[model samples]
Target: MLLSLEGLEKRFGGVTAVSDLSMHVRRGSIHGLIGPNGAGKTTIINLLTGLYTADGGAITFDGTSLVGLAPPDIAALGIARTYQNVRLFKGMTALEQVVTGCWLRRGVSLWASFIGLAEARRAKKATEAHAMALLERVGMAGRAHELAETLSYGEQRRIELARALGSDPKLLLLDEPTAGMNASEASAIGHLIRELRGQGLTVLLVEHNMGLVTEFCDTCTVINFGRLLAEGDPHTCLSAPDVQEAYFGRRHDADRIQSLR
Candidate 1:
């Protein structure tokens, strides 16, 4: 396993966001996490990324324990993630934004960076070249010079992905990568994610798009009301009675949910 969460739990005063959540992500595979709203999916991501501390649990990455670490520390360990809402610097050009992601890997000190040491300058150039390559990989090379805020929502999402990839992560956690995208744009991103897995990147995706989940994920884990409901192959878990009842009750159009499969 590349990533493992065992008996994870989180609570906020009286509300339990995630309880006894546990799962494993096989190395180099795309794993999906799905559930209805407020089902603690995002909470699980936060816990794994160190944005929030787990109340009780164990998170291990490549055999190293990850409990109580800071977000930057976790990120330094080759775990990278993108937010549900795009979090790019609005004023920064796409290239600059992506370059920022590689800053941690650069060895120059702050003073050296300001004075532009020979090594620092060389590192900056190399980082720029690497960022541009990542942009091309995600189909955003043409927009590298544009401000991040000016791009369409889908394009902005792609830029964020490029930034995350800038760190050369071993594991990537994506939250709603295609949340507001149109069907065509969503499909494009779905294809891009699958391709990333082909390149040996392990992906853990928290998404509401069942269509993309079924099409891309090798396996999935479903949760409802902060509890695990099902875990298995995407197609099998999607059709499980517990998942159907939790996600497609009488209040929803069952046919619409079924059509997604």
Candidate 2:
């Protein structure tokens, strides 16, 4: 597995966000994590990214134990993520935003840059060039110089993804990448995700778009109230009676949720 969570538990005071939950993502595949609102999906993402520490359990990535590591350390370990909400540096241009991510992987010392060394200048130039390439990869090259805050919602999403990709991650964790996109925009993001998988990048996708989940994910893990409820092929697992019950009130509402795909 590229990433693994076993016996994971997280509590916020009296509320248990995740409890004894476990799941795995295979290398070079898209794995979907889905559930209704307040199901602890975002909490799990927080735990994995080091924003929140696990109370009890283990998180392993590529054979390394991830518990207690700092967020920067986890990111340096080749794990990168996009937020459920678009997060970009307010004043920075699109290319500059992604360049920050490149710096995470290949940065010259601040002292060297401050001294105006030739080598530091060369490295800075190379990093900017690479960031531009990433922007192009996400179809944002044309908007590379635009301030991230000024872009439309969907456009900002593309920039966020490009920035994440700048880290050259072996595993990408996407938290609702298609959250506010229209159908065509969402489909474009899905295509980009598939392209990444084709290049051997593993992904753990947390999305509510059932159509994207059903069509893009290789495996699906369903959770309810922070507990694992179902796991298997996306279509079949989602079709299960219990899974339907958790999403809707009863069997009849199943069709309504199922229609999302």
* Model 2 misplacement above 4 A: 255-261
Every candidate's lDDT: 0.91, 0.92
Per-residue lDDT of model 1, residues 4-53, tens digit only: 98888899999999889888899999999999999999998998889899
Residue 181 deviation, candidate 2, in Å? 1.2
- lDDT (tens digit, per residue) of candidate 2 on 117-215: 998989989899999999999889999999999999999998899989998999999999999888898988899999989988999899999999998
**TM-score: model 1 vs. ground truth:** 0.95
Task: In model 2, state the lDDT of residue 124.
Answer: 88
TM-score for candidate 2:
0.95
Error of 2 at 166 (Å): 1.0
The lDDT leader among the candidates is 2
